[model samples]
Target: MSYATALKRAARHNPAWKAASVFKVAVEESGAAVLDASGEFQYDLAEDTYALRDFTQEERFTLHQPYDGDAALTVITANDPNSDHLILWEGQFHKILEVLGADALRGTVRYRVKALPQDEAVPIRHSIIL
Candidate 1:
């Protein structure tokens, strides 16, 4: 079977896939934004670290790592012109920062995204939640 078909089947029958949350994508057209796609994918927070130093003589510091606002998403389809698209996941909007990877044979793509500032985020529509 083709990779896409296999992926579709897995998404339908796999327990892990069934537990994943759905995410919506919006694309701009004619000055209006419209829903372009929706899918279920594995979402995870990307690791981020910060260095904190003591005020004493020695230049010593510790890494204060945490899950930053950024996240990694793996999906079955690619969002073209990613910057122009907004993803609504977990009741919040996120902007795609970059494509991490894509595998045609596997029918999957990975992306790095950061949550949009509240002022810039569009409200999520009830119809798009699914």
Candidate 2:
């Protein structure tokens, strides 16, 4: 429904994410020179709401390398999910990447991603945290 909702869903399997902060969202551009128009995220970690900042020319390309390009979110965690043993949640974004071939969000890609082992899902509320 919303980015906040998405994060909450992503958090069920990642309790550490409960305190995680979404800092940035970078997309892959088609021109090969990552633009800054695709979309940006407004984060309120304490409340768990990540909204689109604005629509613009998406940024892409890292001339330094290929495949190294990634659509990623910079996160500040309360603790290292892996080291803390709370990183049970597997990342499904890669699945989308696999299906889309790493260029799905070219114009604007919309899809719902679910965490594996469905049972881990829990109800979440929108609020600003972290």
Q: Which regions of candidate 1 deviate over 4 angstroms?
A: 18-67, 78-81, 117-130
Cα RMSD of predicted structure 2:
16.7
lDDT for each of the candidates? 0.46, 0.28
Pairs in clash, predicted candidate 1 = none
Backbone clash total, candidate 2: 18
Q: What is the C-alpha lDDT profile of model 1 across 1-130, one tens digit per residue?
A: 7674567566666543322222443334464445424532323222111111112332323479665666666555422324444555445556677766677575655566777676753534443232
For model 2 the local lDDT of residue 22 reads 27
Question: Which candidate leads the pack in lDDT?
Answer: 1
| Candidate 2 lDDT over residue span 3-117, tens digit each | 4355456655764432322222222345232223333222222322221211343355557876543333222232221211111113221111221112122222221222234
Provide the RMSD of all predictions against the true structure, rounded to 1 decimal.
12.1, 16.7
> Model 1: how far is 94 from its true place, Å?
2.1
| lDDT for predicted candidate 2 compared with the true structure | 0.28
